[model samples]
Target: MTHIYNDPRGFKEDMIEGFVRAHRDRVRRVPNASAVMSSRAPVKGKVALIIGGGSGHYPAFCGLVGEGLADAAVIGDIFTSPSAEQVYRCTKAVEGGAGVVYSFGNYSGDVMHFGLAEMRCESEGIDVRTVLVTDDVASAPPEQREDRRGIAGDLYVFKVAGASAHRGDPLDEVERLARKANDHTRTVGVAFGGCTLPGKSEPLFRVDPGRMEFGLGIHGEPGVSTSELLPAPELARLLVGKLLEEAPPDADGTVALMLNGLGSTKYEELFVLYRYVSELVERAGLRIHHPLVGEYVTSLDMAGCSLTFLWLDEELRELHDAPARTPAMIWEVKR
Candidate 1:
């Protein structure tokens, strides 16, 4: 039972229309497409960063548009990839003459469509490079890690990519840093309930009362494990333990920790969980840097959350703490 809009097919268009209006001060729609670029996009002489993904994740591909973030974002239907034509149109708006780097979660449809856009750019002489994010540790085994799905860890990929471009790094360097961000990040999540897309009377999946699904997808896809919902502290220990087992960082190293709500979880609940999450990180002998707790990425109305750790080396730490001015995020350089 979704209570959001008029028509299902027209839902995405309407949402985008309203989004640009509300954020007009910061973003503008690309002519003839659903892409939205920063009001100050095309920062000539600097590399442009264009990010895209399916709709439904607010403050993601759209809200992330602004200075020091993505230059433009291509919009697709709810959980659906945008067409090559739509992505192609984005190049015209965000191309800053240096080049454009298209980065996004490593989903099948996104790969196909964005790949098409990559070829399109080559034909038109617009230098566009693609960097796919694969950071969801639960989606694949370490040996096949490259095949994993990209989840909330995408924020680090976009942030580092955007920061690199903002600093006028060459396209090659930007792509390298974007991939490095992906390599340095890992995420694992759980879902307590499922989400219902617009015009649907039922959720995509279901969980019994007092039970939960582990490693669930953002689109309501089931996870690798399921069990009764545990208390906040226990849940925190479980999540941190799983992530560390997957890829343990240096005991004395620092990491950027993010506790993200999957759309329906409350900030209060997340804070309670963060208390224990913080303790575990310190006990693990790792210092948490710029630990963020909020709804940065989400599933439609799924009552769940995910934990992400971007293992920070010197360069990653510097770029991550750098200033970023976007519709949904802004930070002054701490220098």
Candidate 2:
């Protein structure tokens, strides 16, 4: 059973209470809302990079709010999209003279609500743009890639946009690079078990004993395939193969790799997986840049992992290498 909380219905609000309190120096509540914004917001001449999505994925929607990442996050309840009103508040709070760039995973509810917020911003004379991260290659076929869902690759897109914005790039430039980041990125994941929502006693789904599921969703959805649990090396081969297969032919041989643990997967297990993944990327004739191995995006205690590859050009590599200081990730610019 999922553990630790007060009232089941009050879970989201209580979590927010604890979050902002602990990170008071870094973030603050959006006032009468479940949203959060970087303490250092509203940089007068720069574009604002606002991100949002469901709760549960900590250090993501909220943890990403700081310099060189997200300027604000319109948060929502577990696995649910934030409301249109919430989106507007965060947008208005962060908009500088340049404009606002709204970035988030490609989800139906998020698309609907963020759209509503966009129209409202335009009517209010605030410039706005959007870049939806659709880097989950397993969600759709190559010919229909736009229909794919966004998963762990959301971080790459958001990070690039935030860095661009931080550098005082205009809204259009930030939006373009973020879309480009999404185009250059791919992710494939496997799950050993499903996650349980807060207040629920049973997991949303389950893998049979001695097996694992592949191409799974972050919100505990079933994957595309299930087979006997393989060793870390074989699992790494399967995931890396799918990503490289779908990568664009023009993709440069350099990649920013993210080996993410989906909640319950231990770090020691991830380190083992990363050892194999690092070798596989090298074997595929790709150079690794800013390779990360840990939980950046995650499901709620779901025991599994995913590998994300962001094939990079000179521009992408520079943006990624720039300094980024967030609650969960702190990357210093190379001297």
RMSD of each: 1.4, 1.1
Q: Any idea what lDDT model 2 has?
A: 0.88
lDDT, candidate 2, 98-195, per-residue tens: 89999988899999999999999999999999888888877898888788888999899998999999998988899899999999999999999999
- Over 1-335, each residue of candidate 1 has an lDDT whose tens digit, in order, gives 46989999999899999999988999999999989999998788999999989988887889999888899999999888999999999888779789889999989999999999889898889888888888888898888888999889989999999999998899999999998888888999999988899989899988899998889887678888899899998999989998888654442388899999988899999999999999998998888898889988888888999999998888888889888888787866444
Name the runs in model 1 displaced over 4 angstroms.
248-252, 333-335
The whole-model lDDT of each prediction reads 0.88, 0.88
Worst 10 residues of 2 by lDDT: 326-335
In terms of lDDT, model 1 sits at 0.88
Q: Pick the candidate with the highest TM-score.
A: 2
* Residue pairs with backbone overlap in model 2: none
